[model samples]
Target chain A: MTESTLETSGRDGLDEQAGGQRNSAAPPRSSRGHRFTSYDVEAFEVPGGREEDWRFTPMKRLRGLHDGSASATGSLRVEVDGSSAAKVETVGRDDERLGTGGAPADRVAAQSWNSFTEATVVTIPKETRAADPVTVTVHGPGRDSTAYGHLQVRAEPMSEATVVLDYRGSGVIGDNVEMIAEESARLSVITIHDFEGDATQVSSEHAHLGKDAVFRHFAVTLGGDLVRVNTKVTFADRGGDAEILGVYFTDGGQHQEHRLLMDHAQPNCRSNVTYKGALQGDSARSVWIGDVLIQAAAEGTDTFELNRNLVLTEGARADSVPNLEIETGEIAGAGHASAIGRFDDEQLFYLQARGIPYDQARRLVVRGFFGEILQKITIDEVRERLEAAIDEELAAVGV
Target chain B: MATLEIKDLHAEVETEEGSKEILTGVNLTVSSGETHAFMGPNGSGKSTLAYAIAGHPKYNVTSGSVLLDGEEVLEMSVDERARAGLFLAMQYPVEVPGVSMSNFLRSAATATRGEAPQIRHWVKEVKQAMGNLEIDESFSERSVNEGFSGGEKKRHEILQLDLLDPKFAILDETDSGLDVDALRVVSDGINRYRESGDKGVLLITHYTRILKHIKPDYVHVFVGGQVVESGGPELADELEESGYVRFANKKEATVQS
Candidate 1:
């Protein structure tokens, strides 16, 4: 019998002590100058693509979002339509909700934060439940121009609301989205990136959940020449729950990257992240990085993040990295899983054995891969549209 | 009467070392409404024959002719062979994550039947098939064999067999890993397919347990890469009473001499 060299690590809990005591020794908030998380774009140096977070991303395709070379030449047309029960206002940067969640960690996000002259704030009043979703559309006029945008969504105490941010058209864009779910409130945010020809978009989204609040964020990237979305979730108090789900498809010569961070800072908070993607055609690429940090104070924190990527054709690459940082052993649970591979031959054979053609079977498998995450989107129309977009992607691959 | 003829069948499989020949000069014939049980010990090329007939890419036919109803079976792709009225109840069914059993069954049915079945009728047929195999209706919504137990996988295989209703069926160790109850259920499903009266069955097994429930019209005892002996149902009884000890000893003696 030969020894198997396959290294398998799934469902294995990391040794709590091995995670280090930095959480206990270091002050929660630094007394010195502004401390830089990756989101503190101004406090950190501009990325040259060699940074750990930016290494997997194609810097050339970013169209100057990495540095300060790209400026706002043209603007993104922003439209906020809310139900009669909700309130929508185009507030200035001085609005209270502007930086309530967190600071922009990357250069493009900070640039977007500084460049946007006006910020759109969509508010769901305390104790008021909205039946229809608040739709925010950011359309880019097809041009070789750069623009900046910021949108703040606040669901007050005990309010229930769903927000859909639909992005389409062309041009370069840098944007920041801030969502605050107050105590006992429920908020579901769906961000869809459906860009046309030669579009480049970099966006950062930060969501802060209050006590007992539930936050669900879905990021669906279907069409784009280059797109990178960084979504960060933090707990404001105990019992806060967050679920981050994403689905992306990268076609030939397209680059789609999704970076997510789940910060469990309060006790009794829970978070779950599941992001799935598929890539096809030569030069098609995708990157998914899921980072979960359970701070020392986050006792009773339950968290698990999973990312799975399916590479369909030759020259298509998928990079998946799942990182978990635990500062205490008193936590309830914390683990992560990431898998990047081509289609399972066994699965293909099984489907083919049932008399389904090879191409149809592949399509079904890819559809199934995205369906698990896409179904988590509560909005019916948006879910159906994403499904159709996936079909179109599959057709483009000639599957 | 549709017939499957395997004449001078030879096949090799790609291994880590190199391409190793498995089925050497195998010959068999089966017509509709007949069952041929191929019994052999481990590594006697029993499953290889089934895979070769099913046109698995892993198994290469060096020199052979697999004819289904007077057409070239080996030349067809895996799905084409399946669509050409061939069914294989694998020992270890692959688990396809994400694709639900209902969708998989409907796709298979459509591919084999050459058209999509009506949604209402398809749902009813799937429900009835699941019920017959003692499977819960919820199983149809679960991904194909993703988290299924051994018995559940076997039952799913039988479920496919019943729904597809192919002209020729290959049962590859379909009795393995099944408990007595599951064995009975699975055997009953196979028997039901056989009773359809216009299908041929190739029952491959290492044990005679399944033969008791679904009797084979003929039993071929395989040794090495070829059939060493062929007889009626009593051959299984004889083999069960003694074993493949004599055949193993004969092969060893021949190798030594």
Candidate 2:
């Protein structure tokens, strides 16, 4: 509360920082190669942590995911459960649906594509509604080895379902996930990065929304040594709606980053993005990047993105950058907001003055900070479990 | 049954210009069943005294002693002071987002009462308290003081004063910004708490209008960060006619001479 937090940074002041490239069209001083994306690993060179997208990431901590040295010596275990209406298939690289959603944009993402052995595809049949949510759990190979994996969640036309992709346990890994929502389909993809031990992961998830399709994505990252996720979304036709919500807590010596891009390629489409994170203990760091591109053809696009971060301790830091690019002034609206606030001393003081102890006061403030997004999870089990996880984090720090 | 003492209290606040002394040396005593009105002009350190006693960090106690029942309150933390029966209904009640009023009241009640109030009885107690203050039942579901109007905030403060039932309540300008109807309701709440006979009350205000509704046993004319005169109810009547001009002029004259 002693300092003024940057609320929005706004579209006019995008070049002031490392991540503030307002328009990816000209991109201030970003590399021209940033716009190139491909399925081939050779398309992306080894990042030296200076590119606009890789600047915030610690390249050394990527643990060879950026290079081709991260060899897969150990096997990755995948578990699929729930949703009897959904069909699960382990398809080889030759499967036609393997790369239908989108391609890789970063070096690590391209490496994951070139290395993974098989892909898990969960498809909800056309015009069918799922009774239970599908849970896909991926456990990494421990320290002595690295694991590469792929997952694709496909929702057929007029179908409705929820998919939970959970990443847990040890080791280093790079992976790709694609979520394709067909015409008029309603799909929600929730990814939880709850890695244990010294796990390092680079995940890129591509989501494609067809005409009139509705897609909702959630990224809940809690435990990790170094976890970075890239979420790219594209709308193929009009009336498609997409929402991406992310919640993360970074502990001591931990780094968690979520990079988001929403591509409004079709007219009359809509998208909303929100992310909240809290960092505590020494050297705890977090990064949130929201890049929204509204093409000229998407004349009626309506979108807003917001990212908020709370730093709970002295050595903890949070970086929030929201970039908005609008090619057409005819669009309905395009807006982005970012805020990085330290533990509000006034908020803590207010609660403590009411006879609540210091620890309880801190917990209350943290809960309130994340309450708005957690309330939107819609899935009861996920919401409750995340609440417990937050409490456990507070207890770990003796808040 | 209880005594609240503030002896030779000096407090300062940090600002851009550096630490500025607010409360020069404040001495006052209020015992059970007694109401003392500390009347002063703006910037005379009236609210500063309230915050200093409540242990707000912004108001640093440079040199002072605040004792409740012979326990040094200055040595206690903010919440500890509340547990020791020293309550301050802040002039601007803070907005605690995501914390429901019911939850906050229960947590504070538990801390002060040394245990959780029985849920069944606690609901009834809170409902009755809110009803007595004319607050809507839905207020319990909302965040504490968030989006509350000026009148609503004051009423909520009195509601806490009633539910918490602290032995000594220091109300800092509780009557400010309240409409006529809200002032009546808030005064009634304070009056009910005072009628308990075992509680001590320190009412801080700039105007005498509130005195018409809730009479104080002692009225202290405050100026120059300390009380200049102490008298009975008739002193309020005198101030009502003369205002604080004479008291302020006397201080200016004393300072120059």
Off by over 4 Å in 1: A1-42, A94-96, B118-124, B248-257
lDDT of 1 at B188: 93
TM-score of each: 0.91, 0.93
First chain TM-score for all predictions? 0.89, 0.93
Q: Lowest-lDDT window of 10 residues in candidate 2 chain A? A: A13-22
lDDT of each: 0.84, 0.86
Candidate 2 CAPRI-style tier: medium
> What TM-score number comes out for model 2?
0.93
lDDT tens per residue, model 1, B1-257: 99999998999999999999998788899999999999999999999998888877788999979899899988888899999999999989998888888889999999999999999998898888889899999898999899999999999999999999999999999999989999999999999999977889999999998998999999998888888788999999999999998787664554468
Which clashing pairs does model 1 show?
Answer: A38-A105, A39-A104, A39-A105, A40-A105, A41-A105
Compose the digit string of candidate 2's lDDT tens values, residues B1-257: 89998898988999999999988778899998999999988989999998899888899998978889899999998888887888888888888877888888898888888899999999999999999999999999998889999999899988888878899999999999999999999999999999866889999999999999998999998898778788999999989999998798665565579
Docking class of 1: medium
Score candidate 1 by lDDT.
0.84
Q: Which stretches of candidate 2 lie over 4 Å from their true place?
A: A1-34, B249-257
Query: Per-prediction DockQ scores?
Result: 0.78, 0.69
